[model samples]
Structure formats: structure tokens, C-alpha cells
Target: MSRNLDLDLIRTFVAVADSGSMTVAANLLHMTQGAVSQQVKRLEDVLDCLLFVRKTRKLELSREGEAFLVKARQLLRLNDEIWADMTGQPLRGALRVGVPYDLVTRLAPAMKAFAEAHPHVDISLVCAASPELSDAVDSGHVDVSLLEYVASEAAGEVVGIEPLVWVNGRGSDAWRKRPLPLSMVDEHCAFRQVVLGALADKGIAWRTVFESGNIEATAATVRAGLAITAWLASTVPVGVEMLTPEATGLPALPAFAICLRFPATVQPAAQEFARYARESMANEPGTRRAQLANIA
Candidate 1:
């Protein structure tokens, strides 16, 4: 006789896979880490297949686990739809969300999911730099904001930690230039400050080659092999290659926290949207850092 998979266990497993850490999954589910571990173990026992390879700081999916993840997501989506049909009230309202320009692509999936789930809700997405997003959250310009903070100074729930990397045009050694050519979004960009400070500390002379608040322009400069710039590991565009500290003799930059911030007055719609963002960050494979390894 075949045993049926427990929905609760599956839910826990998805959370763990999405967040890449048991502790984070536990926090998201409001369960103890031990409880989350037991749930995963129980699920593995039921399937007779190991799901996750536990590591020092994160969980990596085993071959079987990777195969299961797709089906698991389908199951959860079906379950949510059924439950919503039975019990979910009509969620209708306008919600303003602030996000960093760099993260718009990363957050698109969650935003799309939320829009589809609630057809009547109007979502106004505002894209800006992290500091502006934070200010928007504080001043009630947005119901929720996703902001990047220096890892040590971050306060909100951390959805992800991204390594700051130096990137230049693919196959280009522009970083070797004396007084390194630099491109930046703006003076207020957190990455800019970090990069500048790291350069200063290393006594590495550098000159600004380009400065623009437009991500596209900055990217263009980098892609044209005109300069090197600092970017998060995951957000590096396709045309650029990451320059390793060992190769470039540049100081390693610190990680940054990707966090969700909420205003004091959060509507139900906003809250629900926030939940979707959190879940998306947890579940999206690209956001998962299986190991705290530095990006080379």
C-alpha cells in the first residue's frame, strides 16, 4: 500500500527549499527549527528518498529533491486555488510597493502571482534606489518596500544576502587600469559607498568613468568595457563577468541584506502582498544561497 504525502509536511519542505535554510523556514512558518527538521525527515521517510543535503549554513536539494520541487510547487498552487475558492474573501484595494531598480526583475514573479491571485487589487509598483525606498516606507508613500541594507546595519527580516562583486565587460580586463575606471548609479547607492570605501582602504586609486541613476546606462558603460562596477552577485547582468578579488587585487566587499519593510498602517491587501513577496524570495531557486560561499 502506498502512503499519502502529508500536506503539512510538504508545505514545510517547500518553505525549507525556498529559504535555503531550516532556521529561516522555521521563522517564516512560526515553527521551531527542530520541528521543521523533523517534518523534513518525516517527509523523507515517507518517500524513502533523501530530499535535502544538509550543510553548515544552508540546505541543498538532492537529485530527488530537485525533481520533487516542481511537483511540490504545482501541488501547493492547486491547493491554494482550491482553498481560495472555498474560503478566500475578495481582496480589493490599491497597494503601493516600493522596490529597488535592480530588484524589479527578481520581484516580478511574486508581483505577477499576487496580481493574478487578486484581480480586483490594484498594485502600484514604485522603483527607486534603496534609500529612497526606505524613505518611502517611512513616509507612507508605499505600503511596503524592499530595500537593500549593509548586512551589519540591516534591521528587517532578511530574505537574502548577496555578495557585492566587481564586474566588467565579459572577457575584458578593464579592471586592471591604474586609477580603476568606475561606473556607478549614484552617490547614494549603497554599493557605490561600499566599493569606494573598500578601494580607499586598499589604497587602490580609481577614477569615475560614468555616473548615472539609470541602471541601463551604467550597465551599458560596463558592457562596453569602459569601466568596472560593483553589483550584487545574483543581479549581475549577462554581458559582464565577475572579477575575483584574487584576480583583480581589489578588496572583497561585504554582503548586503535584501529586506522587506512595511509602513505602520498596512492594509490586508498589503499584508497579503508582503506574504507573497516573502514566499517568492524563499521559494525562488535563484534567490537561494545553498552555501555562504563568496562569488568568484
Candidate 2:
């Protein structure tokens, strides 16, 4: 006797594997937890194996579930590929993309050009911090993202890198002093670690006088001469001067990387958008200038 399995059951199974919780998977699939549980049970019955083990606060994957997840991801990917091929659509659909705030000024214009080139596609641009943006992409809330690549979770190809320079209000000499008072993003920021890490490595003293999570506020604090702070060269607000050792006597951070991430299941139009991002960023004058300035 042959048994037929439901595709919805398989989808629920994959969502549960990805989310690690029935409630979260239910939210993703827009189904109730009971429905999700029933589907998982149906899936298990068809496969005749236990899939997940519920612990105190989380669901742990059994060895069988672990193997099943790999297969589920492959099946979903194959299905998407097959569906896309069969339809032969131009990928005209709403695409939501997550980008870090700083890239608005640096890369938004190029993205606008991409949108103009593909007028049929509706695009939604969400500006967020790197970690938040990455989370959005990982959770399938956004099609693609541009974010920083820290030593932790350094998974994607390097898309852009620039020196993180100390910037201060024009004519401010605070950066020239030892144990600088700094303006910085709050604890949740990706660059907060980068800044603190670099200072700790050099054994430099710093006091965080301002901890606004907003980049604009951090830059404004620096511009008002309240504190000196590190900034990516491309996104540094105009009129604030980059601190050189001649001016600040502090060693410069030579390079920090930015990256683009998309699911292995990203759609064709999304891939087209990513290609545009890669190509436009490759020709970015700001990035080029920063690299040259760092060398010189």
C-alpha cells in the first residue's frame, strides 16, 4: 500500500524545524498551535518516526528530526524552483528589503535606480540596525539585507568594507586627548562591539557619555562636540572632521566589513536586486575614496 503525505503537513514540519517552537511556527504559518501540532503528528505518522522533543522551554530536535529538516529544506527549495520555472513569471511582486540606516545616504540612490529599471516590481525598504536587519532576513520577513559581518556569525560574502574613523565636531580637539569621552550607539548596536573591541585591543580608555541607539543622535552628539565617536567613512555626517593621528594621536581602525545576506531560497527578482546592489556598491566612490585614504 502506498501512502500520500499532505504538502501542508510538510510545510508545518519545516516551519517547526526552523522556528523550534510550535507557537512561533504557528505565527509564521498563520495557523493555530493545535493545527500545527496536528500537522506535525500527521507528518510523523506518515513517516512513522518521532520528530521533535519538547523540553521545559524549547523543542529539541531528535536525530530523526535533524535528518528530516535537511530533507525538508531541500524539498521546499526544489518545489520553489519548480514552481518558478513552470510559471515563467517575470518576478513582478512586492519585495521587502532590509538595509542599515547608514546605507540610506550611501546606497539608496543606486537602489532607486534599480527600482526605476524594474518598474513592475514594488519594493519596500526598511531601515534598521544590522543585527535587527539580519534577524528580519533570517526570519523570512525580508527578502535580503545589508548588514555588518562580525567575527561572530560571519557567514556571508564580504560586500563592502570601510575604515571606522574617529570623527568629531569641526575644530574639536577632544579626540586629541587620551581617555576620550565618546558618543556611541546603545548596547544593541552591532558597531558598539566593534568600537569597544578596537579600543580594548589598544588598551585605550573611553567613557561613554552618550549611548543613543540612533545613529543620527550619535552623529549629532559628535557634531555638537559633546564627544568623539567612530564612524564609517561613507556615512559620516558632513562637516564633522575625520580624526587623523596628527590631530588625535589615536591609531585608526583600518577596516570594517559590511555584507549582504539572503536565504539560499531567495527569488529571481530578489537575486536581480542583489546583483544590482553588488554592482553599484563595487563602483561606490565613497568606498573607493576611503580605501585610498586609508592607504595614503
Candidate 3:
């Protein structure tokens, strides 16, 4: 006889995996932490495999857990699709969304979930710099936009704050250059503005060695040890090390606000998309802490 997997248990597991904390998953699911733990244990028992490697302060997925996560997400998505098909009005519309280039990777899971839940909604994604995204939202060129701005200048629902930090290739001597070689995006980039202003304020002589609208190219430049760049602590690409201001003698950068801007008349599809994005960002690993730390 084969045992059926409980949808509730699977949901609890996914929540825990996504949030990386039992307490957070419990709050999100409106269940006690003990209940969440029990559900996880029950799921593990059914699979006869340990899902998470319990650490002192964090929970990491074992190989088994990582493999299970992919299947679990698929199952949950299909379940949601079936339920939505059976018991609700189907959503059908076009939503044009603008997102900053750096945040696209961070928001991928949320976008995937939204796509799975609303198959009929046509989503057009526009990836650009923050200023361009904001302009798109203001000009009605896009239905919604996820943008980054200086905290004091932001005007939307603040989702999170990302700490700005200098980044360079790991094990590279790029920081020791007399006139620092800098890599940056285009002039309209908020990060570029902040980085340049910080360097100028500190009287640090720097020269732009690479400039591109492409984040990958800029990160590649940094990774090649040709230049150093600044990015959100969380968004720093792989193979790069975040530099400490004190040790590197670089000016400290203030946090940047991550926010959502939408048109006044939001369609149902757009509203649902926004809601999902908000919830995903809230539960996103590291986002909650940043949000809490930057509350002002």
C-alpha cells in the first residue's frame, strides 16, 4: 500500500525551507513552531530521509532535502492549478512588469509561483536599471515596477533595504591600486550615483575602468580583477568578496530601499502579482531582517 503525502505537511515544509527558520514559517502559516516541527518530522518519516541538517542558528537542506524541494514545488504548483481551475474565476490579462536587473534573480521564485498560479495572465517582464524602471512606472509604460532608491527619496511601499557594500574579486589585489579602478553600470543607476558620491566625498581618487548597462558584464569586470564595484550585500554575484569599509578604507554606503510602484488603477492580475511579490519578499531569506533593521 502506498501512503499519500499530505498537502498541508508539504506546504509547511516549503514554508520552512523558504523562510529558513521554523519560527518564521510558523508565523507565516499561523501554526505553532512545535506543530511545524511535528509536520516536518512526519514528512521525513514518510520519506524515510532526513530533510534538514539542523545547525546552531540556521537550517540547511541536505542533498535529499534539496532534491525533494524541486519536486515539492512542482507538486504544490500543480495542486494550486487544479484547485484554481475547479473553484474560482480564471484570471486572464496582460501585466507589464518592470524590475531592476539586480533583483531579477532574487525575485525569480516569486515570479515562478505567480506564473504557475495564474497561467492565463500574460506577464511581460522588463529588466532595466532602477531609474528606468521608476520612469516606466511613472509614465504608465509598465503596470508595476520593482525599484531601488535612496531610502529618504523613496515613495512606494518599502519592501526591504539592501546594505550597500564594496565588492571585488576574491583573493585579488585590486583594492591596493593607488587610483582605484572602478566598474559601474550606466549613469542612471542609483548604485553608480551613490558609489561615485561616496568616493567623491571621501576624496578618493578613482577612475572608471569599465561601464556597462549589463550587470553581468560589470560583475565580470570585477571578477576579472580589473576593477572594484559596489552592490547590495545580498546581490553581490558569486566569486566576489564584500569589502569592509574600515579595512579597505572605502567610504561607507547607506542602505538602499527596495520598493514597488504601481499605477493608480491596478488590475486584478496586477494586484495579485503585487501581493505575491510583497509576500515573497517578506518571507525571502534575509529580507525580513533587513526590513526590520531599516524600519524608520
| Per-model TM-score versus the true fold | 0.68, 0.65, 0.66
Question: How well does candidate 1 score on lDDT at residue 186?
Answer: 76
User: What is candidate 2's local distance difference test score?
Assistant: 0.73
Candidate 3 Cα deviation (angstroms), residue 65? 48
lDDT of 3 by residue, 1-296 (tens): 87799988888887677546788768667779999999999999999999999888978788998789778766765675566557778788888988887888877877899999889999999988888886676556788778898887664557887688888998888987969899887767888878888889998989989888789999988999999988877777778888887888888888888987764334556656876888776675565356334421
Please identify model 3 stretches exceeding 4 Å from their true place: 1-88, 286-296
Model 2 agreement with the true structure over 1-296: per-residue lDDT tens digits: 88665767877876676556898778767779999999999889889999999988878778998788767755655666678679877668888888777676766766888788788889988888787876786577888777765533443446777667778899887675567788877666667777777788878888887986577888888888878987677667776887765555676565667776664346666666876787766776766576447633
Where does the lowest 10-residue lDDT sum fall in candidate 3?
287-296
Residue-level lDDT of model 1, residues 1-296, one tens digit each, is: 77677888988887777557787778667789999999999999988999999888778889999889778756655665566557768988889988887788778988999999899999999988888877676556788788898998774457777788888999777888888999998777868778888999999999999888788899999999999998877777778888888877889999898987665344567667877888876664543353235473
**Candidate 2, residue 113: CA error in Å?**
1.3
Steric overlap count per candidate: 1, 0, 0
**Best lDDT among the predictions, by candidate number:** 1
User: Model 1, 1: alpha-carbon shift in Å?
Assistant: 46
TM-score of model 3 relative to the true fold?
A: 0.66
